[model samples]
Target: MTESIEKIVAELPSLKNVTGAWAVTDERLARGDAVFLADLGIALARTYGSSRQVWQYRSVFDHLLRLLATTPGRDNAVQALRLVGSAEVAGRKLDRYVTSLLASGHEVADLTAVFTGQASEELRACLVHELVLRGVVVEETPGIARWVTSPHWSHHPLGRLPVRLSDVESRADFPNYGAHGSSHSMPYGPLESRAPMVIADARVPSVEETTTQAAAGAMAKAVANWAEESNGRIEARLFVFAEPLDAGSVPEALLTLGLECLRGAGKKTELSVTACAPAQVWRVLFAAASSGGAYNSGSYGAYGRLAAWQSMAALAGCPEGAAVSEVEARVRDGTWHVFDADTEWFEQVAWDIGVAALAPGRRDLAVLAATDTD
Candidate 1:
């Protein structure tokens, strides 16, 4: 990857500008922000021992770079890049370009030109080319640079197969989670026109802190509002992403609290509860599917959604059909169960499929070998 990046920088005459801005990025990364480092570590860990994951990481890294570069000027871009570049991905720095940007004031001016509206078409092309070579800028349209994010663990082993009919969306399209504060939000996809949704941001002061009554009250209010507007059927799916081992009882308590509140509201509420590791997309899907609700697994969540969707789609025996949704609904309706002590076995199978997708001989084609029945 370093060799590829070097080759790109060497070929682009306007490389001076791109390199200088990256130097500022390097300085920021060296400071060691905890959150940034943690995210970087997860991204890199998933990619280790698997080339497919490595490419996925690269795609996301490049997408992040383009976003930082889109900042109005050198300083802002530097700040944005610093916010994301702490990861130890290969070829993060453009060696010669960084040296040139630091040593020559004239080169810094050239780099500034591209971001500050002083660049020529040729220079812009050169910068764009360098980015493309590194997998940062996926496409360029005149003044616009279209960026892309690689799938996260949420979509995993399935690759990028779509669950819904209108799934042509980009992964980099959602608002940043850091921007939304620490509260939880709802409606994993389009309200489905059928499935009731509730996402509880149950983060508390500590593991001993119980917010079951408050969460139940919130859901009751939501159910009441929805009941007045709709046909009055309240089928609520509660997903709890809890942090502590002892905290597992919180979701259990909510089930009782939720049922009691539903009785008062005079509405029949089919409540389904799922508790899993905090901040994981798999648990969210686990909650929805295990509860017999429809799971979208769209661009809004992590990388595992895509992979899960693909695997479910295949297991349902309909590659191009809406079988993924059907299976989710079945799981919600108590027809299928996707979690247990055996889940690790399924995950291992999925990971093998993913590794095979990046086969050394033919990486371009999407092929899954057939099983013999003889």
Candidate 2:
């Protein structure tokens, strides 16, 4: 197997004679040779940075993606995908392939299930994210959604902040800390008149009672690691309010809390707050789950999705053993009030600073402030 695959890889670079080389590879691939597929996958990874130009490798990618769409070739193709990380490398071609596979009547669950037990958790998460990016709505099954949305995978891929697919399409307008950062706040209409208001005479929960320590810890970690650059720092804190306030007052409330959290740490500054619809918040969290915090980059896989679910579960205080779909349903139902703000403390690149969410009924507000020079 090794010698035969080596011959194939060696002959592949002969661009003029590549047709004959692929003819041999095609015959072997058609027979469903998993070992050959796996070896070829590894070889493809190595070949990516070789002296040959990228376009010359198109045949290799085409074969892998073609096999990826077929049932017999699916698992081996996934293993190859794991080795090559083609979701990042192949980009649109991968998207078109996945899209075509789905259009051809392949069940999303069946395709996603191919990744189970075949790849590392992180790779699985990234693959799933790639599938979602192609507009595939993955089923919320234990093997699929649960793994991707778990918080355990969140810390491994640093600076992976997921955003909605729609947002990804309009990424030009999406906020980031980069040169293209948007100056405008996230636009949403006035809060619904029927939206729940803060109870009069309500008492703020103690730091200990506002939210579970685990939730707070996860939020802090997420905010701190939201970006890849090392020059910036992020702080996340949860605040509970007990005073009488309406949706109209959330910005001021958030501003007050923001001021308190930033006190003594740096120069005092005021934050410009904006009200975000619950639907928008849901999309952000959903994007996180779908893309594993990759922003517009192709999916990183399950960790981002898992972390988003875990964060919501912790915030809404969902019962143990709750289904991810149930949690998602609740989030989409406006159980949380969301807001984002900006301040001078950080060079507001992206939506890094002044992002916060208030839990339904409990009034627990989670605030994240981030500053990134890069």
Candidate 3:
């Protein structure tokens, strides 16, 4: 963990380039695997806004890992990791499918056609190996497996395209020092910036672009290494997508960029990047869910900051329309402050009561915001 922290500090530039640069982590409270990923996650969290609860989940996972590892009957850190690692493994599969489609210029879900006869578990294992050695394909999104890129698309002797392949390589912990972002903007666009050639049309000057690239590159490397050392037995991959320079709203964009960066790993993995921050992606996801008190039910790509907003909004009973107006009124009246992650949980909890917008029945939401939220 110390080594990871040192590495994280070294990669601080790239870590800061993330959209939630203001985020923080309590490494002292973390341990085990979660502790290992904390610095990198915290670094990314700062650039990409994240909830303290989500941040705390690292501790939760770490605690579980230690317990699993220490179990006397039949210690099975590997199997117990299934709780989190299984989800990660599934996510990697999603990456392979999406990246393959994008690299081959296939449409979403349409790529499954390529597997009509060949999409076997064995083939998937082989494809996983391929993605481990090449670094050409470029498409990544969070949780959702959508792909884009053409690392394997080269003209054949007959002027025909041969088997399209995506390349990937892993040199985790790349560092960036000069990245810059002030006010925060989320990165959300359609599949226009496909793989092997992702270009964010940020309306920034040349110097800012240079700094953003620098920061982004550094963050990419750190994330890659973290994923490499992470629960690899579970089949995991790392990706990093680019958001508009310093776009504060970073939840979705961060996850998307993370997927893109995974292709950088030396291997041919089929994965794709779905462009969307959180509002649209997550709200829609909730719309598809089976419950309101869903845990980790939202898109891993976006909605990282929803914990804070949802927490405060519920505490104050602030509804969407009139509540927003009331919150605005409070701000104008100096009765409330901008949703700040500047203090302790107790402070935030106490402040919730002062806001007149919070109403009944929303404590469930607030409970999630504080305990199971994020």
Candidate 4:
């Protein structure tokens, strides 16, 4: 028999490399399979936002992953994930279904068993109804499943039009650096149907000067003029190259342009910032997320383009030889962060326009003098 889970949990973190070995092992830790175990490990890595939390969860997560993988089949996996997602665990729970299976003598009913045409119609209909509510279409022949539309569509403020097939590519030129666009616009209006519109990228002298009240007001007027004459919908993207330290400035500049100028007063616009600096990737992500903007790195068409995910994987103490593609896949599959990939996660988590109002501010010497300086 394999070592007890307590001992394994205690020893797993000390192993220099566990991902590869874990992938091949069927060693069960709370009844999850190998695949489930690896995914849990990655999720634990991403669970903690701080470095200290990362270290604290390392061993517990490693041991938790030693459980078996997620249960197979679409309906079964969904039900299993939902159950565990609701259950509380110190580390990620791989497959709670298996735990139930071992505990209940196979009495628990599942959609997979009902599809054989042996189960009662009432039971099968109940499962089918649930899948329909989830917007999933299931085929009985091959047991295939597909989404009628992305469940994520309504979750994003921009609504559904920005789906993958409709993404547009355009370009902009700042004085010093060139920008390429990866944009998506809503299809509800003629203006958004413009496919792609070219806009000049900002070439500010420095980060501190990137955003200012005057500049924001000027851009707001321009966006207002565009919105007044047309059906209201806007989306745009631009890229910039800067040192990692200065990269945070790009999104900040873009935020002021989007938030202060056009986003309020019943308007919607999404402006994305793409950069090349690996070091500044996370900072850009947090700032963009904070301001309800979008950010990414590398080519939009290319794989392994997100520097934030790459950096997060490293920071989470992922396997030494892990590939960018592997990390990216984990990001996509929700292995790393609770929200999964920051690229898409940020889009959904963006701050709502008008939720926060800008408060009055004072730069005047009179106001400053009135304040206690002594």
- How would you encode candidate 1's per-residue C-alpha lDDT over 47-102 as one tens digit per residue? 44145534433333443343333323444334332333334432212221221122
Local lDDT at 190 for model 1? 18
Encode model 2's per-residue lDDT on 175-269: one tens digit a residue.
Answer: 22111121223232222222322323433333332545565556643233345424545555666666434545555555455343344222233
Residue 336 alpha-carbon offset, candidate 1, angstroms: 13
* Candidate 4 lDDT over residue span 1-374, tens digit each: 44443444445445676553343334442244434444444444444423463353544443332232123333433333332333233221122212322112212233444445333232333333223222333432233122213353243322211222110111111011111112332111112221221234544332222333432332222122122333222222212222222322333333443332233312133433333222232332222221112222111111111222333343322343465455434333221111111122122222211111111121100000000000
lDDT of each: 0.28, 0.46, 0.25, 0.28
* Angstrom error at residue 46, model 2: 9.6
Clashing pairs in 4: 29-67, 32-67, 32-68, 32-69, 33-68, 33-69, 36-69
The residue-by-residue lDDT of candidate 3 on 38-132, one tens digit each, is 33433434442334444433333333333332232221222222322232222443333222222222222322332332233322332322222
- If scored against the real structure, what TM-score would every candidate get? 0.23, 0.48, 0.18, 0.25
Of the two candidates 1 and 3, the one with more favorable TM-score, higher being better, is 1
Cα RMSD of all models vs. native, in order, equals 21.0, 10.9, 24.5, 20.3
Each candidate's number of clashing pairs is 19, 20, 84, 7
Model 4 Cα displacement at 316 (Å)?
36
- Best-to-worst TM-score order: 2, 4, 1, 3
lDDT of 4: 0.28
Predicted structure 4, TM vs. truth: 0.25
